[model samples]
Target: MGKQIQLQDAAYILKAGWKLFSRRTSLETLQKDKQYREFIRHNEAAGRNNVSDEGKRVYAVATDEGVLFFSDSGKGMKTRNSYLQHLADSFFNFSKGVETLKLYEMEIPSRQVMELADNSIDKLAKSDLRNAGTQLRKSEFSFTKEKMAGKEMLEGAVCTDKYDLRPDYNNFDRLTKEFNLGISPRNYDVASLLYISENGYAGHVVADYFHPFSYEYEFRDLAEKLDDSIKARQSAPMSLHDFGYAALQMEAKVMARDILQSEFHITDGEFRLSGKANRTSQRTKTPEKCLFQQSKEPEPEKSGCQAAKHVSSVVPQKKEKKQLII
Candidate 1:
């Protein structure tokens, strides 16, 4: 233990030294960035596969270039989840990845998240449920539950709400917050929706600004309480507002597997995204498109967020209607 501690201390010193040296302190920093840019470009043209070091890698940023590759190779992968530590690192000031072995859940509910939705029932503001499908198909991302929860979570294989602790709900709360959907039918119970939809698939299928909370939620209730009847479907590929729709295709399969495995204790190998109807409707105004409302949708501009958006190629909860030509 003493030797290990000494080695870690030495590594820390070297790591800290590298960071300090890497800092762009002034105009000279800009010059160095130009140099790095040239190197990155040249490497790209040299036919290098975006092949990063594989195994278990955690990133400070999701974008490929910005991500920090890490490995817990010597100790065995599950011993400490370097990935979750990478995630929890954001919520905390520490540089080391979140020690999932340490945190049980990201946030424990004093009241079941169900209560949060219930209490806010009357207070949710009226916002549009963007149904008009936008083109989000060509976009893709690698999705997984984030790590910020404590130890039991890191060591465990399942990333359920009971273990994740990022929220009792899922990205629903985050989506609502980002778009500022001040509690109404539109903002109603985003967290609960997210919690239920975690392993299920969702992507940026469409965007429109209208007040359709009551309309959409009443018709498209987010969570499924053990409903096996909901057959998982994958429609023909046209990437319009594909987030939730595509996700449904995936999550349905995952949830189905979980139910069968845990409840029935079945280890069936015959599982895939099949046996569901895949209908492709001509791209028209989606269920979110409304004649009852006036379009106040503004053009979205990419405000100088160069590094943060690198990881999430698919902006799932975005309210923008314009397609970003990457």
Candidate 2:
């Protein structure tokens, strides 16, 4: 079996696939294309429409290059939905084979994040803190029960609201007050938002301007639950926003699979590259091993019979027909 691709590498592959596919097509073209329109029509007939009351639509097209998906809400509220479009733009840029820093790789200027946390804490009235503490204690009881049952203790396990421990706002405030004491900005890592779709396909994006909560040791489980909640809303009769997000998640999986299949055979979620695919990639990169390259040394002449044998070995010969005995 081929070595399993790390999630980071998989993200790159998916990004490249989307860029290539998007270059070959656009959202407008896809909306007008017969195949995509037909797909939407079929879905509508099946009582799963992608159109929203606001005239926004989310759709996908299957092209030879790969599947291209789009969440198009025309020109009016473009600014409001620009975040979604920015993700597509980022995918295209990342696929340009340039050295672009990914979200997690970028050094975040944590001053803004710290300030934001501090301001939020300062705005919380004493009554608000008491209410928040009451909520956390209520949530903690259920979370503790789930933890005792060996469910919510894992690092990255998805837990519902009933099973998740609400962030202790009071603790968060205490930590913020002591932030300058020993906590360096470097102490925090950017949290990644992981999503598992309704179809059981998983994808993740690194948070751009956010870090883990000051009081939280790890935020993976929280991010996962947030993702799960978002995905849970992406169902039949979904809003335009939800439909678009769902389409993007589904498209990512499709593009990833397409890329993997070109280089590797997938079986039961395992990937294995065939010998021919591996050799072809290697030969293309190594000039001396290229099939089109000619040998530098002259070949020795062969006898006519030997030449004939060589030709027979390389080329297929017609089979002789046997005479039928009546």
Q: Which candidate is the best by TM-score?
A: 1
> CA shift at 309, candidate 1, in angstroms?
26
TM-score for candidate 2: 0.15
Q: Which portions of model 2 miss their true places by more than 4 Å?
A: 1-241, 272-326
Give per-residue CA lDDT, model 2, range 201-273, as digits (tens): 2222222233332322233444455466466554533444453444444543354345334432421222235
TM-score of each: 0.16, 0.15
Ten-residue segment with the worst summed lDDT in candidate 2?
304-313
Per-residue C-alpha lDDT of model 1 across residues 1-326, encoded as one tens digit per residue: 33232333334335434432334423245346553443334334344346432212221112211111112122112112323322332321212222121112112222222121112122222221122211112222121323122221122122211111122122223323322323343223222223222333221211223322222232233334212222222232344544355454455445534543343232222111243212221211112111111133433322211111112322333534322111
lDDT of each: 0.27, 0.26
Q: Tell me, what's the RMSD of every candidate?
A: 24.6, 32.4
Model 1 CA deviation exceeding 4 Å by range: 1-175, 178-209, 212-326
Count of backbone clashes for each model? 35, 0
Q: After superposition on all CA atoms, how large is the RMSD of candidate 1?
A: 24.6
